[model samples]
Target: MKKQKIFALILPVIALGGLLTLNALKADPPSKSKPAVAGLTVPTGFDINVIADKLGSARHLVITPQNDIYVHMASTRVSKGIVVLHEEGGKTTIKTSFANYGGTGIAMGGGYLYASDKSGVFRYKLDANNQVTNPENPDRIVTGLVSVDWHQPKAITLDNDGNVYVNIGAPSNICDELDKNRTGCPLLDSAAGIWQFRTDKLNQSYKEGVHYAWGLRNVVGITWNQQLNQLFVMQHGRDNLHQMHPKLFTEKQSAELPAECMFAIKKGDNAGWPYVYYDWQKQKNMLGPEYGGDGVKPADAKYINPVVGFPGHLAPDGLLFYTGNQFPERYKNGAFIAFHGSWNRAPEPQAGYFVVFQPFKNGKPDGKWEVFADGFAGTEELKAQGRAEHRPTGLAQGPDGSLYITDDNKGTIYKVTYKK
Candidate 1:
């Protein structure tokens, strides 16, 4: 037990060098009865394959025109912040070495590779081969964001117009008196929201960026909707509702209240976090526990409501507005969400380790969201110990219009293709 704890402490650094020596392992054939990709379900005529796996904490990913795939690592889960994978003859293999800072964001914009650790964002210039020119040293793009133990990942995205957006996740569960908010949570000033910066700018601090949106608790799932020319984000809802305010909320209510929300981000939007949360069942923004309100109370009228919402604690981590032509017409301009399941739903059994699709038309929600992909959890019923076989954390589209997903827990990457 002691050894296990210590090993977890230095997992990224210790396993990184050794893991790189591993030969590329082909994707296991999907099994209809198992958690395998074969077991997973997708739309008609769509197929999936695991290109790579056993990577330590692969987070977000980007596929360049050169067919090079760059995956960012979750801090403390992998040795390098960025891991490059190249494919030749249908098999993909990891590059030997790369960026050292741990992070959860990897994006390509303005001819540079952008990555982010817990508190900052950095970038590396790309060469003719679309490879980072200098892996050892990356230029600081945005600095001193925010990083407290919880929800610290600085997942980043870039718009087509060269603006960079960073998610500064709020660090606590509703910022109660017991947590970081004791003396007044200063994190609210620089965290729990989205900030916009110039992609070309270097050495810029948190204060330098424009606070584009607020009240977003933690937005690991963020993407620029190029089709609509807008930003979209999936905000992870707050937890610990019943534990903190047992008198007001039942365990079941806490498990399902405050639905994870998807927002069509417009400039100066405020979704209301820490002080309020969206109730999916109620279809209303309600006051947060810390702000003194019962579970049924309504929140401020000014706060924006999500375009779509899902059950609580599903932990949506990756968001992609599909503009690719490989999929059916129904999916065009629609959004795909990777739900990295969080087991707060306890005795009721955990849920979500799958991807959901939201159909959109004219840049707006046109119908109900539905499960587009499933079987990541590898189990019909969640175990009491609370763990999923694979949790999808990031999503990207390849040049050929194939969808790419990364599993942060196992460092797996899967490509989904559709054909008529």
Candidate 2:
């Protein structure tokens, strides 16, 4: 009996050892049974390839001139919130992983690589090759940003001058105050907008930053248009229009009423939130139900309008302006947006699991937006059920003009190249 018990315990331990060895051998596991690019659809003459796989919550990424790719994760499980990749010959592999914190929004500017966690932005010194030399000891450029419950990721961008903008998202859905009457949304005093700070300043608090714009509920995708010399941002629209006010909006109307907007931002600009939402169907901004409009009343004219509006709840997460010569002339200076897909369009099929291209001319949108890449959800049924195998989360352009996309679901990285 003593030998029998000892044998059983050894058997279980042996099995566990085998399992761990197997997992260790398979460092890069496939996300699905199907090939990574099996269902992907891109425009003609453009082909897509999976450069890396199984990255784990890859959020935003930036590519250096030397072709080194740095991907940020929402968590630290896989790469400890940051993964640096390098490609040699035909294979791309993780060169190293660093950073103790993970969130989103990474960019390269002013000879430094800037990355943000939920509460602050940090920067690492780059060497002559544009590679981070001091990942272990990054400088805390800006600190003390607000983050509570919802809309907390501090998506960041930098301007040509010396300014860095960080998005301080609001915590409320509509600032409803639990259905109680309120005069004004006090949350707007500190959140729901973008704040600008000097890049040269280190360890700056929220009090030292200046409010660049106000009343923008949450902005994740922000960029500076080099062609136009203007700042652009993608605003996540409010939700639960029908559930909050069923008498005013039907389920279908709620699913498609408020449009996700792209705004050309300027100092003092206010894309009204908790008070109005842009109705793409009506081509007008409508008053929010929380702020005393039944759905048909137009919002006050003082509220600025978006440069372009898209279907609601699509969740625009990344934006990049293409200035690469690798593509045809038609793509020059166009905007590429990655929609992270939606989860809230219940009672209706969820939409937006692809990347889109918006044509631009003379520093403004000149044509309608078109689907540039698709098949991210894996299947039609999966998309309808809001179960995505992989969702595009961030975009970066290589020095050679190749476009790189990151998937947050499975940590997949895709590279798109144009061939004539």
Candidate lDDT scores, in order, read 0.78, 0.83
lDDT of 1 by residue, 37-122 (tens): 33666766777767776677888889888788888877543445677777555667566457767878778877798988877888
Tell me, by lDDT, which candidate is best: 2
Among these predicted structures, which one has the highest TM-score?
2
Once fitted onto the true fold, the runs of candidate 2 whose alpha carbons sit more than 4 angstroms away are 1-34
Worst 10 residues of 2 by lDDT: 4-13
As a TM-score, model 2 comes out at 0.92
Which stretches in model 1 have alpha-carbon errors above 4 Å? 1-20, 23-38, 76-79, 178-185, 382-385
Candidate 1 lDDT at 173 equals: 73
**What digit string (tens of lDDT, one per residue) describes model 2 on residues 1-420?**
011100000001011223222133234544433366455888877877777776678888999887788998998766576778776455665666678988998988888989999898999888898888898999998898887868888899999998899999999888886347756788887899999988888998778899999889898888989988888999999999999899999999889868999999999998888888999988898889888898889999999999899999999999999999998899999999999999988888999989999999988889799999888888799999999898998999999899998999977788888887
